[model samples]
Structures are given as C-alpha cells and as structure tokens.
Target chain A: MVDQLKPGKSIKDTYVFDLKMSERGMRINRLAEWLNGAENREAFKSDMDAVMDRFELTGEEKKLILDNDWLNLVKAGGNIYNVVRIAAIFDVGLYPLGAQQLGMSYEEFLETRNEKGAT
Target chain B: MAMIVAGIGTSHVPSIGAVVDSGRQNTPEWKPLFDAYEPVRTWLSDERKVDAVIVIYNDHACDFSFSKYPTFAVGAASEYAIADEGFGVRPLPPVKGDLDLSAHICRHLVYEEEFDITICKEMAVEHGLLVPMDLCFPQQGEWPVKVIPVQVNVLQHPIPTALRCFKLGAALRRAVESYDRDVNVAVMGTGGMSHQLHGERFGHLNSDFDNWFLDKIESDPQAICGMTHFDLMEQAGAEAVELIMWLTMRGAMTPDAQRIHRNYYAPMTTGMGLITMQDAA
Candidate 1:
C-alpha cells in the first residue's frame, strides 16, 4: 500500500484507490444482502457469486478481512476510511463537494473502466 | 498588543448546535460525540481568555452565492445577519463584530499585507461559522466576544490550495501582530476530519488518515503542507480534505505548540472531529 502511495504523491492518489475500494464494497454488500433475501435463494447464490467475482478486490483483500487482521487489512490496501468511502459511494449522506471542486460530475467520478455493471 | 491565543480545528457539521442544545447528546448513539466537547467548552470559557476571535472560516455559499464569489472577504460590520441557508437561518442570535478591528484587518490585508481581500460592509454569515460558534461558546444566546471574519473560498472550485491556506495563516499572524490596538485573538480553522458528503463517496470517514493528520499538524505540518490539491482530492476525497484550512489556524500557532483537546466521532456520513491547541509554549 505504501508503494501504492508514492513520492510527490497528491491526496488524490489515496482518494481514487479509496473511492474504487468503496464502490466495490457497496456493490458486493448489496449483492450479498439481495442474495440472502431472495425468494429463490439458490439461484440468487449463483447470480451473486458471479457478481462477487466481478468485484474489484483481489483474492488477498477478501482473505485479510476474513482473517480479521486489522493491521494487514490496511496493508492489503484499505482501512475504515476506505470502507467508509465505499459506503458513501454506495450509501449516500452529506452533499459531496469534491465532484464540483474537481470540475467533474458525480457520475464522472464514479465512472469505472468496467462498464459491465455501471450505472 | 494584538496576540494570537488559540487555534481550533473541528467539523462544523450543520445542525450540530441545535442538536446539542436540544439534548441530542442524551440519545444513546450521540453522547460520545457531544461529551467530547465538554473539555473544549471549559477551555474556551476559562482558559482561552480570547477577547476577539479572528474567525478564519470559509463560506459554504450560504451568504454569497456562486453568481459572485470573492476569493477572500472581511466582515467590517458591528453585527452580522444570519443569511438563509435554503432552510431558514437558525434561531441563533446575531454574531458580534468589532468594526474598528475589522476595518484595521481589512486595511492591513489590502495594503501592508498585500492580500486583496474583499472588504464586505454588509455581509451575512451562514452556518459555516455559526455552528462552530454555538459549540465553542454555547452559553451565549448572543456571542460574548467580538468576531472579525476572514472568509476564504472553499465552496467553489480552484479554492486556495493547501499550501496557500497555510501561507495565508502565516500572513494573518503577521497582520494580527501588527495591529496597533491592544487585543487578544484566536484563529479558528473549521472543516474536514474525513467525512465526504455527496457522490458515491458521501459517507466517507478516514479515521486513520485523520489521526495521522492530527499528529502531522502538531509535529510536522510540512508532511501535510507539502501535499498537492490532487493528493488531497484523491486520498481524502475531494470534499473531505478541506482540512487545509487548519493550516491557517496552525499558521497562527508557534511551530512547537501544546495541543489541549482532541476528539473524533462518526455519527453520520461526515466525521465529527474536534481539536484545540494553543501557543502557550
């Protein structure tokens, strides 16, 4: 993660990673919850597993959270703030000022390279 | 005899004051947030013996709108009106302003300071200021100390960069010290403790980053100071990194100062962070 944060790096370096990390979390959480609530739970599991597979997290990030290694969790490249950023990206709260500050739209900031499940 | 007294950095979460005064703290999830302010309350009342507060806060487009925003502005009035924040303005009393001192600050920043700040004679203050005031000076129906407002540009794009905010603080220190009249002042830098409102990242809270930032603010501001707008925008979320304003507050303090009180809570999407440091050193 430190390598991910480099020399002469701007706060944006950390932010884009966090923003992407958060979006992954929200999409995964919603899919999991939706799968659990399904009338046809078994079919939803297959659908959810596919959705989960599309999540941006690598195998390592899931392992870190599962192992509950809070320290290594950050090392794996996300922390409470990272998770919260995902929540904000998925969940909604205060009116965001960054998009306007960055001269971009909210949708523009959320645009992912993978348009498979994009809004 | 103008002297800098204290530097305050906290989240001016709108509706904080009304929530606290109405006993919102008694609610199970909200107590820790408000309880953290008890020390700040005691300090501002007894220790921070600040005669006039030189509020170094930014406007949230509540008073002056996007149609005509000034890079920097100074309030040169005896009292300020609570402008409508889309919702009606809060029922709080009008904030007191020391016209004479404000006039002096305005002149100094324009002439001696060489900073071209808009001298606002009929400016109205919005929640960007009033909420923080309600917390630090809670007992007052009307505020006790006079205020000299220095409004920065944080609402619109191309805001003063983080380094610029810090430099402005140092310049403000020079302005305060050069004032001919005798006055004790405190500079407050409000906003940012890692809460992102808006977009998909609206509820972001960076406690780790927040803690790291607090330490850097005291020991090595250069670490934070050297950061770029892109860095802050990306790492701390575009909105959450406005903590640069804290540099203005930091600029008012001695490089090696004493931190009095610090607290951080995430009750909602935004971080309810608070810190109080003084230059008694």
Candidate 2:
C-alpha cells in the first residue's frame, strides 16, 4: 500500500503523504492526532498497550511505537506531523527525531544545522 | 468598501513561535529573525492601519486531520483557538475573527468567483497562522487586529494546485472588495522557504531555490503559478511545497504591486524569507 503512492520521479529519502499512505496509517495517525488532548496524552502514558489495543494498531505499529523507531513509523505510512505528536509523548523534538532517523547523534545533527541553538 | 492594503509573505516555522513564547527573542540565535519583524510590526500597525488580516496557511495535522481535510477552508467564526500541536498551546490569546468580513468573503467566493471553499465556523489555528501573527503583530491583552483564517491543504497529496491556490487569492481579493463596510485588510501568506523534516532528506535547505522563489513570487508570479508539486518537492524538499500558499497572497495583489520590504534568513533548516508588498499607487 505504501509502495503504491510513489511518484514517477522519487526523491531519495522523502515521503509524500498521499491518500493511500493516509488510509494505511489511519489507525496510528488517528491515535497520534488524539495525543493533542492532554487527557489523551495521559491516557497513553498510562496503560499504553490498552490505548494501542483500543486504536486497534497492528503488532508492527505497536512495535514501532514501543521501539522508538521514528523512521519506520514514517515509512509505515505515518504522517510526519502525526509522528511528531507521538514522539512528543516521549519528550523527543522534531530535530532529535530527525537525527535519529538519519542515524546520527543529536549533537552531530546540530553541527549540520546553521543555528545549533535554534533547537 | 473593504480594501487589501498590503500583502506579507513569510515562513511560519513553529520554532519561531516557541522562541516568542519562551521570551528567547533576545537570544543571539533568534534575535535577528525577531528583529526583522520589528519594523514590519510597526509598519502594519502604524502606517498601513490594517484592521483585519486574511491569513493563508496550512494545518500541520493539528486541527484538521487526514480523515476529513478540505483543500481550501475559510474561517467564518468569531474567534479561533490556538491548537495544541503535541506541545502545550502557545501562550497567546484566542485569535479574534471578523465574522462579518469572513462571511462576506465566503459568500463572494462561492457566489461570484465560483471557488467552492469550505466555510469553517470553528477552526483551530496552528503555527501556520500563529507564527506569522506573532511576527507581524504585538498582542496586549487581545490581538491588535482581527483575522480571517484561510487554510490550504499543503500537507496531504492531491492538494490544490499552485494555480488553484493563486486563483483562490484572486477570488479572495474580489471577496474583500465586494464588502460594503470600510476596512483595510492585509493578506498574509505563511509557511515555507525550503526545509524538510520527514526522512533521511530531513534537513534539506535550498537557499538558492528559496531566493529564486522569492524573486519570482514578487516579480513574475506567473512563472510560479505553473509549478507542479513534484517540481517543488524535488527542488525544495517535500514540506517546502507549502510555499504554494504564498502564491495565494500574491494573487490577491495587483500585478504591479510595489515590493516594500524584503528579507531572507537561512540560519536554521528552513530558509526564513519575508516580503511585504503594497498595491501600486
């Protein structure tokens, strides 16, 4: 399903969030979107497995969330913004998540940025 | 009669809002970006005397999810809530809306221009709108100017075309002018100046493409009007496609609009670009 949405010409590491990706990642995306609510964040923090069960996330989806695999979550059709919400629960920011996705330490990623302090 | 006094094109990076909220504007890393807006803040409030703003921005999966996303959504509510995008909501007051003006724009777009925009009575504005507002306006207890939120779907695919977004701005101009009340409006195009945050190409920044886009958006928007989503994503990363929203602001102005102020800063991942324009005298 995720492979179906690739454009005729593809960027090396970019993911285009299309209808198919949206449909495939609906459960995880919806669960992440719900994290916008404070109560929902708390609910997930405590008994996360129950919340995952309620959202009916697949075993792989559960593993991605538990394993802190930001890149796989995105590759599995999770929208980047929705994935950011899930990562925020663990106090991970967009920069850190990107660093992890790029297989670099946060400091190494900061060195690549023009304004390291901007983070 | 209502008039669009000016148009502002800016990057609505979320971190800017965080800096403003945390009182880190004086810090070296952010001072330059915040300082650039000081003159803009003064100009809009003092010189232009803008009463309301039409903000063209995209929802970053905050308020409206993929479940039911509108390609083009216009806010017709009396107020808009600041969205909590995972982090706590920014320390800002609710955005006051100009319902009469909003309704007027909505009616004109549908009836006269034939742009079938979704009318949102309850819309929660995220960084796309807030960051621009934070940059251009100073808030006392309440915001200085009321807003009419115009949300474009730049997140998901099959979103509005660049031409369509521009046409929406043209329709918005007509909508604003058709209103009977006398009001000065400023249309703000917020988001993008090239930066991606998705995958291995996460830290993409194209200052050259950003500069070229700024030049075209000001001088020959027609050149950009034909840009395909693939072209934009290829040149400037995928998320930078949000630059299309800026065309909506350009489309609202006269073809010979005077470029008043221009600034570009690429200190971080996103190339923060700003351009202010006014209709030729």
What lDDT would candidate 1 get against the real structure? 0.64
lDDT of 2 by residue, B27-117 (tens): 9988888888888888998999999999999998889988999999999999999898888777789999999999999999988998888
In candidate 1, residue A55 scores what lDDT? 55
Candidate maximizing DockQ: 2
The TM-score obtained for chain B by all candidates, in the order given, is 0.94, 0.98
Candidate 1, residues A1-119, lDDT tens digits: the string is 12323445544223332333434444333322232222423443345335445654457655543443333433343423333222232232222233432345556644421221111
Task: Indicate the docking level reached by candidate 1.
Answer: incorrect
Query: Per-residue lDDT tens digits of candidate 1, residues B1-281?
Result: 88888888887777575675565655656667678878887787678788888777777644664446687888999999876543344677788899988888777778876788888988788667877787676635778788888888764445666777788888888888988888888888887777654343544566678888888887788788888655665656656656888888887788888889888776544666788888865
TM-score of every candidate: 0.70, 0.97
Listed for every candidate in order, the interface RMSD values in angstroms are 17.3, 2.4
What tens-digit string does per-residue lDDT give for candidate 2 at A1-119? 12222457688898788888888999999999999888889999998999999999999999999998999999989999999999999989998999998999999999998888886
